[model samples]
Target chain A: MSTVRVENIKKTYEKGQVLALDDVSFEVKSGELFGLIGPDGAGKTSLFRILTTLLVPDAGRAEVAGLDVVKDLWKIRQIVGYMPGKFSLYQDLSIEENLNFFATVFNTTVAKNYHLIEEIYVQIEPFKHRLAGKLSGGMKQKLALCCALIHEPKVLFLDEPTTGVDPVSRKEFWDMLDRLKARGITIVVSTPYMDEASRCDRIALIQKGKILELDTLEQIIARHAQNLYAVDADNRYNLMNDLRKNTEIVSAFAFGEEQHVTLPPHFQDEYLSAFLKEKGHTGIKVRKIAPTIEDTFIKLMLENQ
Target chain B: MRNLVFLLQKEFRQIFRNPTILRMILIMPIMQLIVIPLAADYEIKHISISVVDQDHSTYSSKLVNKMTASGYFQLVEYTQSYAQATKTVGDGKTDLILTIPAHFERDLIKFNKAQLHLAADAVNGVRAGLGTAYAAQMIGDFNREIREEWMLLPKFNEMPQIEITSANWYNPHFDYHLFMVPGILAILVTMVGAFLTALNIVAEKEVGTIEQINVTPLKKHEFILGKLIPFWVLGMVSITLGMIVTFVIFRFLPVGSFFTIYAFSAVYMFGVLGIGLLISTFADTQQQATLFAFFCMMVFILLGGLYTPIESMPEWAQWLTRINPPAYFIKIIRAVYIKGSAFSDLIPEFLVMIAFAVGFNALAVFNYRKRSA
Candidate 1:
């Protein structure tokens, strides 16, 4: 059974002038770690808000844990724990107070759910007497997670939790999420970081309130029909400029140290290397490589445009 | 019910944790109750007058003496020439110039009438108007005293005179603070209820914590009740504090039952806190809510008959007070405190308060969107 199901959800803002979510629909299976991958203002937060019962979708039905979002919002609220993108715990409240408050409000206590948040809470336990606002970003993240899990929610929704976090803490947060998922909790998280997509069981790539693709990391990359090659040369900018000026290349962008490009059916890497050498005599390397989720997102964006 | 208890606990914790808000809840209202009524005393005390006695008759001198003895006026200058007295008025030395005409005493004995020229500097209009009215009353009393003297000496023509006796019943001394303390207490309570509640939900939204709370299973009415009850208690606390200050400094006590005052305040808190909630619902930020609540509070207090009587206001402003929640509280508070009025006498205001409590709260709760539009 699906833990969460959304069908034809649409949302708009600014009196319907800006389309925030456009007929967006997807499903998260029970106990699956699902990621909504998109850029800023790409309707990721809008979708999360709808699924968590914080918002009403314009034109669709969303069900969480077998209950309709709109009709059974109270029931959905109990089963889902939502961590908004911003740090929202009361600044004046001590860390322990914040945890206890969230737990008590949920009609549960920290001790009742102690084993669930035990791992994360221990990391923040030393600073339990400190104000929640005065904690470091990583500690705050853990505290937020602990609060969210205090009631042992069946599903958890995290919106851009690791956006501003350091890479090390980001990895730590993901690891903590992995343990929660092991306990059979369905996790739905949205992030703009393409690298995090690889950690999820399935991901729905959304943009402009529309879902472009929904599949696993391997499946999304495998589904890319065009062959991709990484082009490297001494002058990275010039290589991208030259590749873009050529009509034979489907799309070309400088990705870190090399340029990633898609090719036409008959395009050859040897020919491209020879062409770049002809323009400016230098050593060049061109080779085929697996596309990342970001590369796939760019390909999907180009196809839609 | 469980949700409400938890939510209230959270709100109270947050309120107590913030020292600034705690000060606002505890100290600011007490200070205002102490300071505002002192500056708000509207009674015109002493008006200086320059008298020009064109006629050096006994009655003219007696009238000047009567004006000076009234305690409301001071004889700043006694000049034979009107020009010198006008110079005193021009120098801002005296607030008014009183000129006695040439025939002063003979006319009152013969024609039973004499007119005095009184010119008041009307810059402070209320002061000038009340001073002139007071001077006129004093002159009338002087005329009656002379008439009574003439009647005792067996006048040739004893024209029948009507006597008017006036009494100041409720406040015999017309103590301004006695009249004002109850109204000030009502205002302090109104401000506490309105301003604090106006900022409550919006402050949560401003800090982005409202989204977290919204995602919880807390029911809408439970959340509103949670927010409402804490500030309702604070509102009553402000009134109680103001009453204590009123008692301490002014030695003034509410003439009516303390139960009546508290009962009315409890009901009035519902209406005032409803106003606060209504403000919070319409405002998105704490600053916006504060600005809006401040503006509305200014209008409500000014029109509330706290410092001024509503009967003396223009037709439309008096009408505006009908919708203002504080106005009814002010009236009921004054009626109960000064008039020793019973609950039945305040039934109309009580009914209006109940309506305001329900009406504003209903609109506020309706506007509090639990599910985002």
Candidate 2:
């Protein structure tokens, strides 16, 4: 059975004025690391809340660990761990106390769950006496993960776990998740960072409370509809303006250090180069490159919009 | 049930760890117990007075001296004219004007009766009313003394006299603190339980720990009990501390059993903490929760009949106070501590508290959705 299952999960907040989730459905198999890649307010948190049994779907059903979310929420709560998008650790407690509290609340002891949390706990163990509020952001993230994982949950849901951490810590957090996945723990995490999407076994791209696509990392990139080209000229601003006026160009947007342009069907790169040159541009380079997840997301967002 | 103990442990640890909240838990009731009752004293004192003696007779001067000597009034002026005495009262220099008319001593010899006029500044009606009553009591004693001197005559057989003496039991002296301290104690306990319980939960909500707890397998009652039990214990401790202060300063202890006070306090706390938990569940932020607690506390105190008697309230409000948990508690504490009232006499109050405890806590747990679904 899949570790987590959601079917046509629809959620509307504020008496149907705001649709936080719209017929969202996906499944995560046991021992697979899945990623929900979207910007903020793309229903990622809502979807996670449903799977963890913290919220109910308006018109759908979901099951975690073979138990229905609504009918068996208590049973699901025992096996599913949720780290909300925000830092939810008790700030007044020390690092050791927070971990101990969570472990005991789960009807277990830190000694019983020590092996599961040892890898994450060691990083914060030296400052175990320090208050959770006094820890650095990376340390707080590590502490929250330790509290969530102390129960040895079958499925782990982490929402935007690395939003404010430094790049190094973000990389370390992903490595930690990778290590947990290697231990046969099913992990479903959400993030707006496109680069993190490649770290998951499968990824779902969501926007405006709807999933645009769901596939493996390689398959998502392989499914990009538009052929992308990097256009570099003497000036990026003037190049973007010139490229927008190009009849051969489909759409152009700045992509950091260069302008990425999509060409029309049955169009060649030389035609774009010739068009740019004719528009008072010189020393321009156009290179066809493989699409990153960011490029694919932008393409899908444009298509959806 | 197994998880409740662990949750309670965590709650106590968190409460004691924070210095500001810890101070509020440990010291606030003690401070208020010492200060609030002292400020709440209702004994009337220091009423300024002036005498207008037009008779220039011994009886008139004797009456003037008698009014000042009673210790409830201060003779600020001794005037010869009623107009001057009225001026003193109008100038806000005195509270009462005693007018002894001419032929005051001769009228008693001719017609066997005398008349005197006394004018009081009635701006503060309670003070004026109490001062006039005290003055009238002293003047009646003076009239009885003169009558006793006259009744010594041969044919005066003291016509059908009845003297009644009253004993104000439990608080014989009627010191306001004796009556006020227990009421304040009840209020302090109520406040500590309700305000802290609500604030503690909303603080958790503010820090986002509530979301973490909500996602756990903990039941709603477990979470609420864990939140409430600590404040309930602290509230009980505040009552104990307040009673200790009450005994130390006022030299009064509950004439009834201590068990009755603690028992009633525990039930009262259940009702109050449940209301507080309900507020925390309804409010999304600590500020909102604090304001809700404050507003409810106003209703609880005003309708609880803490400073005023419930019998004095409007008929509609008295009906509301029947359901107000604090009102039932304050009456119970006063009757038990002062009157040494037994449980049999408080059965109605106890049953009402039982209903409130069950009703409010059940409603709180019902409104408190662990699923947020």
Candidate 3:
């Protein structure tokens, strides 16, 4: 069954000058870890706010756990957990106090559902007496998650929960989400990092307030995958500027030390090397590479444009 | 109800943990209650007078002596040149000039009356008016004494005289402290209640905590009341502290029952705090909230009739005071504290205060939406 059903949702701000969401629609099945993957200003936060009933859609409807986002807001509020993109916990309160406060606000007790957050809580429990403001970034995130989950909400909405977190903590956070999913909780998480898209069971790639692609990880890449190439040169910067100058190159984006690019169908690698050699380039090497989710995302973004 | 308990607990914990708020709630009232009353005393004294005594007679000297001995005026210039005295008045050195013409007490002995001239610098109208009145009173007393001595005493029943006796009621000594303490206390309670509740919710918005709270199932009134109740308790504690300071510094205690004051304050706080909540609902940031709160408080306090009597205000201003929440409370507090008025006697003010509380709070709760538009 669909736990969340969004139908052609449209939202705008500043007297309709800025369109935040346009005809956005999707569904999250029960116990599914659905991801909304997009860059900043992609309407991810706006969509989450609408589904969580914190905002009203300008011209569409949404539901959470079969409860209408507008008419049944009170019922939805009791069942859904929303951790906003910004750190919203009271900074002056202790970790334990913050957790207990949210629990009580939901008309439940922390002791009643202590096992739900126990895995994440035990890590932060050592510093439970410390003020939330005093904790490091990763610990603050964990405490926020614990507070959001204290009532064992059926649907959890986490907006960019891993944005500012370090790599190791980000991995640990995903592990915690995996465990929560095992307990049959539906989660809708949004992130700006394209690499994290694979961590979800399904993702809807959103851009400019519109969903570009929505599919399973393998299905999305298989349907739109192309022959991507990673090229290296003596100078990475010059290599990128040089590659963009060629009409044969579909797109070239700098990815760390190597520049990943898509070439025209049936284009020979030697022809590119020969073309660069004529432009005073030397020691150029190119090889075929598997397309990453980021590469697929870039291709979809280019196609939409 | 359970949700409200948690919300209240969180608000109180945050309030107590903030040292700045702690000091504001505890220290501000006592300090202002003690210092403002002492500096705001309105009984005018020490008027400087220049006596241009052209007639150096005994009566002229006696009148000047009586003026100085009255403790209201000082004999600054005793010059024969009226130009010099006029110059002193122009220079702001003297506040008044009394000219005893060259009668030399001859006119008083020969005729039944003598002429004397008194001129006051009417720059500061109140000071000049009062100084002139004091001088005229001393001269009148001297004239009466002269008539009693120089002329034969009138027959006991020859002149029919109607004597008027008057007594000061309420504050018998006209104690400025007693009159000002309760009024100032009313303002202090108002300021604390209004500003604190105004900033509380907005501060949560700034810190981004309201977003989380808004997503929860906590009802609108529960959240607002949670913000209010703690500050309401603090406001009452402030009034108690201010009263203690009033007694400690001035040895003045209210003649009315303390229960009446608390009952009135309880109702008064709801109205004042309701205004603060109303402002909070309209503002998005702490800066906006503080500015809105300051604007409302300035209007309420200025028109509150604490500094000026409502009857003396212009008709429009008096009309405005009728709607001012603090004005009603200030009048109620002063009446109860000084006039020993019981709560039953202040039914009209109580009714008005209840209206304000209900009207403002309803508007606030209605304006506050758990869902964004």
Q: What is the lDDT of residue A126 in candidate 1?
A: 91
Question: lDDT values of the candidates?
Answer: 0.87, 0.87, 0.89
Model 1, runs deviating above 4 Å: A225-249, A257-265, A270-289, B46-124, B135-165, B344-348
Residue A35, candidate 2: Cα error in Å is: 0.6
| Residues B1-373 of candidate 2: C-alpha lDDT, one tens digit per residue | 8899888888888878878877875687678777888887677888898888889898888777887887889999987888888888789998888878889999976888998887899998877888888888878888877777778886767666788989998889877777877888888888888888888888888888888997888887788778888988888888888888788877889988898898888888888888888887788788999888889889988999888789989999999998888888888999988999887788888888889988988887888776772
The DockQ of each candidate is 0.57, 0.62, 0.65
Write candidate 1's Cα lDDT for A171-216 as tens digits.
Answer: 9999999999999999999999999999999999998888999999
Candidate that beats the other on DockQ, 1 or 2, i.e. the better one: 2
Give the candidate number with the greatest lDDT: 3
* Candidate 2 displacement at residue B370 in angstroms: 1.2
Top of the candidates by DockQ:
3
Superposition error at B337 for model 3 (Å): 1.2
How well does candidate 3 reproduce the true complex, by DockQ? 0.65
Q: After superposing candidate 3 on the true structure, give the runs of residues whose Cα lies further than 4 Å from its correct spot.
A: B48-69, B74-165
